[model samples]
Target: MRRDTRNRLLEAAEGEFTAHGYPRTTVTRIAASAGVSVQTLYLAWGSKRELLRGYLESALAGDAASPEDAITRFTGLSPRERLVELADLVGEIAERAATGWRLYRDASAVDPDIAADWDELQLLRHRLIARVFEDIPATALADGLTPKAAVDTAWTIASPDSHDLLVRRLGYAPGEFRDWMARTLTAAVLAPDSGADTTM
Candidate 1:
C-alpha cells in the first residue's frame, strides 16, 4: 500500500512535470492528480524539488542499469542482433523519458530548482557511463583517438537518441542498425585492421 501510493504520486508527478514542466507544477495539483492529499505528497517527497528529482531519477533508471547487463543482453547478438535489441531498447527507454526530457530541457530557463537537478542528473549520467567505459576492451584497442575521446564516441554511438535517429527513423531494422553501429563503433574504438569493410 505504501509503495503503491508512492508510485501513484510519482506517476502523477511525472504527468504533471511533463505537462506543465517543473516551474508550473504545484504540490496541490500533483497531490490532487495522484488522488492523494498535499500532506501525503509532502510526506512522500518532501518538496517539489524532491518530486522532480525522483521523476528524473526514475526516467534515467532504464539507461543506468549495470553496464554488464547491457553487454550480456547483447552477448549472443551479432552486431546486427545487438543493434536491433538496442533499437527496441531505445524505443522503450525514450518512451519513458519523453516527458522528463521535455521538462528538463525546457525548464532550465524558468526554474533554478529544475536547472540544478537537471545539471546534476546529466553529470551523474555521464559519470556512470565513464565508469562503464573504464572497463571496455575496445578502449584499449582503439587508436588515433584519446582514451576519453574513444570512450565518449563509443558511448554516444550506444545512446538512445542516436539509436532513435539512426535506426528507428532511418528505416533500418533494429538489427541492421545495431550491427552497423557495433562495427562502426568498433572501428572507432580499434584500428581499421585493413580490408575490414570487405569482412562485412
Candidate 2:
C-alpha cells in the first residue's frame, strides 16, 4: 500500500512538473492529483525538490534491464556490434529519461537546490558512460583516440541534451536516432582498419 501510494505521488509529480514546470508546480497540487494529503506527500518525499528528484530517478530506471547488466552482456561481441548495442541501450534510456531530465535541466537554471541535484545526476551519468566505454577494446578505437577521448565522445553523443535536440526537437524517430548514434559512434570511435564494419 505504501509503495502504491509512493508510485502514485511520483506519477502525479511528473504530470504536475511537466505541465507547470518546477517553479510553478506545488506539493498541494501534486498531492491533490495523486488523491493524497499534502502531509502524506511530505512524509513520502520531504520536499517538492525531493519529490521531483524521486520522479527523475524512477523515470530513469525504466522497466528494461539495468544498464550495468546490459553493458556486461556486450562481452564477446565484435566492436561494431558493441557500438550498435550501446546505441540501442542509449536510445531506450533517452526515451525513458528525457522528460525528467528536461525538468531537472530547466529547474537547475534557477534553483540552487535543483542545481546540486542536477550536478550529481550528471556525475552519475558520466560514470555510467565511462563504464560502457571501458568495455570497448583499445585496439578497436580510432588511431590517436585515447580511452578518455572515446568515453567523452560517447558521453556527448548519448547525452540527454543531444537526445532532446535530435529525438524531441528535430523529430527523429527513436529508431532513427539509435541508428544515427550507431553510425556516428562507429565512424568517430573505431579505427579504419579495426575490421568493424563501418557501413551505415
Candidate 3:
C-alpha cells in the first residue's frame, strides 16, 4: 500500500540519518537501504530535508491519544503523579531520540530550513507540556511562579538537551534521569507539601 511504502521509507531514512547524518546522507543511499528507487523516495517526500522532517516529526510525536481521553487521564492524576508521569514519559522519548537529535543539531547549523523546523518543534513541545499540567491547580505550583514559568521549568527539565547531558554524557541510567526530573520538578515547581513531592 502507499502508506506502507511511505512508512518503510521513513523507517529506512531514520537509520540513514542516524548512521550518516543529515548532511552526509544521500538520496541514493536511503533508497538503496529502503529497497526502493530514488525516484520513489523523492516522489514520496519531495526532498531529503522533507524526509528528515517527516522522520523527526513522527518520532517526536509521542504516545498518541484522543483529546478527551488525555484530559480524562490527566484529571484523574494528582498533581505529584502528573509530574512523575511527565518525567517518565519525557525520559523515554529522550532516550529513544537523543542520538537522532544530535544529528539534527549538527545538520541545523548549515541548513536554515532544518533550523527553522527544529525551532518550531521546540515551541510545539513547550505547548504540549503546558497542556499536560493544565488540570493541576495553580496553588500547587511553587511560590511566585507563573503558569508560564512553571511550564518553562518543566520543559527545560524534560528537554532532550538536558537528557543528553545528564544521561548520555554523565552516564546516568535512564531510570535515574527520570527520577531526578520528577524530584527536580517537585522541588522547583510543585508546592512544598503538594502530594507531588514524593522523593526520588
RMSD of each: 5.3, 2.7, 3.1
TM-score of each: 0.67, 0.92, 0.89
Residue lDDT tens for model 2, 24-130? 99899999999999999989888999988988887787764564665575666777887788898889888888889999999999899999989988888878878
| Model 1: residues with Cα > 4 Å off, grouped in runs | 62-92, 138-142, 155-188, 194-200
State each model's CA lDDT, in order. 0.64, 0.85, 0.81
- The whole-model C-alpha lDDT of candidate 3 against the native structure comes to 0.81
Candidate 3, residues 108-141: lDDT per residue as tens digits? 8989998998888788788878888777778888
Number of backbone collisions per candidate: 6, 0, 1
Model 3 misplaced stretches (Cα beyond 4 Å): 62-72, 196-200
Clash pairs (backbone) in predicted model 1: 79-179, 80-179, 83-178, 84-174, 84-175, 142-189
- On the 0 to 100 scale, the lDDT of residue 182 in model 3 is 89
Give the 10-residue window scoring lowest on summed lDDT in candidate 3.
64-73
**TM-score of the candidate numbered 2?**
0.92
Query: lDDT per residue, candidate 1, 1-200, as tens digits?
Result: 39888889999998888778787889999999999999888888888878777786677567556434554554444333333454455455556675666667577777787788777766665554454444434424456677578657756776655655665478766566656665676566655442222211
Best by TM-score: 2
